[model samples]
Target: MKLRTLLAVFGVALALTGFTLVAAPGLASTITLDEAVLVFVGLLGVLQGVRVAIARSRTAYEQVETPDPEASQDLPTPGDEFDEMLATAGADRREREMRESVRNRLERAAVATIVRTEGCTEAEAKRRLESGEWTDDPYARAFFTGSVEGASLFDRIDLRRDNQSRYHRWAVHAASEITRRSEGFDA
Candidate 1:
């Protein structure tokens, strides 16, 4: 049974017992067990009702009000939000890959240029690039002087406005040299 119903029944029983005791005063003194049991039951019912009331009030206060359905319509659905996040991440990955590709192409061209002009091995050219050491040759110096650590390809280009054109020229030159070597041609 519900707490309210149980408490109400106990209250009614207590009132009947009190009435019975008042109607028979002589018997009430003789019935010590019945009086004590009724008093205990009454106190228990009152305490339990108070506890139930407090619990109900606390839950009511803790309950959250529902947001208006019209207001919620303005919010993006989970799927739409997920798609937006995925698109942003994909774009970021593509941009990073592009930057890395440009950086690699610049390095390869610089390495190939050094090997062709200075008569050095590719490994030695790469080491020279890393060491920031340049030869007297203008072409080699052009590649070497443009080097900057941790800078993006565009940032490097911005540092020297001509570096962008230089990078393109060097990249073409590197590709041609690779093709020539692969084809077993001295040129």
Candidate 2:
């Protein structure tokens, strides 16, 4: 039965029992069977409501209100050691090779970005890129067609004003270079 209905029934039974006990002098002196049952049922309804309230309280407490300790501790920040690794890798590579690799990575990053934004899989994004379906897409056109000249493809893609933003620009530039090289353009 619904909680409200059960509560209403319990209240009515209790009220009737109380009225009966008050009217009868003999019943007022001693607890009757009907009065006992009504009290028990009312207590049970109250207990049920308390139980539901407690359960709901616990569920609310366990919800995503607090930040996860592991998540907060483990996730890399903008100025983390990972940035050093990327810088070292870039520095280690010859200028020509580095440029090509960066271009390839950027292209892949662009595809990944589109896939994430469009809610598509990596495979779908790759197909779109390979098939030239992204020629009309503003992001794709900007990255691929060299539409925005002088600013390096990286700069265009790194719209965010942060450390990772610089990395994004570099990635785009690298990917563009890789694409050009693959198409037999001089490095």
Query: Which run of 10 residues does model 2 get worst, by summed lDDT?
Result: 178-187
Model 2 stretches with alpha carbons more than 4 Å out: 1-94, 127-140, 147-187
How far residue 78's Cα lies from its native spot in candidate 2, in Å, is 3.9
Q: Write the per-residue lDDT of candidate 2 for residues 87-157, one digit (tens) a residue.
A: 65455544556445544655676576556555678888777666545444333444444444345666555
lDDT of 1 by residue, 1-187 (tens): 4667777877897799789989999878886887788878778877787777877777745568997676434766644543343334334545555435654655786677668766899999898866656342333334445543444677556545652344444333334444444355254
lDDT (C-alpha) at residue 36 in model 2? 74
Per-residue lDDT of 81 in model 2: 54
Total colliding residue pairs, candidate 1? 0
